[model samples]
Target: MTVPSGIYIRKARIQDVRTIHALLMDCSKQGLLLPRSYNQLYSHLRDFFVLAQDQGAILGCCALSITWDDLAEVRSLAVAPECRGQGWGRRLVEACLSDAITLGIFRIFTLTYQAHFFERLGFQVVSKDNLPQKVWADCLHCPKFPDCDEIAMSIEM
Candidate 1:
């Protein structure tokens, strides 16, 4: 799907971190996804792809963090409230998937509340146990660690 006119997806830049953090935080407060700290965002800045308007406002962001040799986790996906349903979120994810393929990784998984959204993008529900233990290291800090309600989904591209 093409991005909405005036909006485009690109690698996250250092200047975009604060806006990305704010967007993720807004989504987190609505119980949409996990929030990341400035530290985490800065450290993993290279993992992010952001959707921005032509005027340069960030509308959404997502990250593809490599988990194991053949696995990568899609996390921190968020789209502005006004921009939902316009295909911007999917575009952000596609950017990540493109990056993954470029890096020679084929398996992409996500712990998400929007299962149908990912499903439409070719992701399937999977058992959490099927994921590597190392994938949970960050979960240790999640508020829902022991009882995460987010559905685990994967797509082999």
Candidate 2:
């Protein structure tokens, strides 16, 4: 097993599920992001974009879920603490944005507490009410649903 010194970003694969799930849970424990069950991760595994080292150690994971024909939400974005300052997060996000563009998605959104971080990537704050109602359909299952404290932000591709 070897590790890639340069950050390597790629689409999530079946084998990457557990690593991704662990990272998401770590972030979720600190409320940095939402947590996904193994079942859900498997169901939407392809929705994830990940950063892995040469030895295939996953550093972070993020997902882009199409909410409407023109809109997509960046969900479950979590970066490993030790890997936080290296820009792997930005890479993971750009990967998601790139995927959205490739899929003909023009509008991308996220609900996050890291306001400045996402803003640095050109995302702007938006009112949760301004977002489509369909986006809320998943709120029922969210730990912070209805009273979610995360700020809503969006970036145009």
Candidate 3:
């Protein structure tokens, strides 16, 4: 995806945690994604990327978290409601995919309600059981744990 002029995609900075948290909160409230706590954001700040204006207004965020050797997961992808349809979401995920490649991780997956969106980005639906058991560590904390309704999708680079 071609990022439009005046928009910047960069590794998230320390100062971006709050804004990223807020964006994630908004997404979670809408059931688009799960909400992350400040502690979680601070701990995994290095895993994130933000799509922002040249002047520093954040419009979106995404994360590429290494889950295991040669494997990673794309999580917390969100774009401002007003910014939907502008390709920012695609750019955010693409950025994560690029990061995965750079880290030499060829397998990536995401658990999402927006399966169709991820599918457009080359992720294919897969059985949740196909993922490593370690991947369930986080799911134990999820409200949907034993009854997760989110789609599991993956792509191999």
Candidate 2, backbone clash total: 4
Top candidate (TM-score): 3
Give each model's whole-structure lDDT: 0.90, 0.86, 0.90
Name the lDDT value of residue 155 in candidate 3: 100
> Which digits, one per residue and each the tens of the lDDT, describe model 3 over residues 1-157?
5657898889999999989999999999999997899999999999999998888889999999888887799999999998899888988899999999999999999999999899899999999887865356688887777788899999999
lDDT tens readout by residue for model 2, 49-147: 888777778888899988888988888888889888777778788888998999999999998889999999999999888786544567777767678
**Root-mean-square deviation of Cα positions for candidate 3 versus the true structure, in angstroms:** 1.4
What TM-score would each prediction reach against the true structure? 0.94, 0.91, 0.94
Clashing residue pairs, candidate 2? Answer: 2-55, 3-54, 3-55, 4-54
In model 1, the clashing pairs are: none
Off by over 4 Å in 1: 1-3, 134-136
Model 2: how far residue 40 lies from native, Å: 1.5
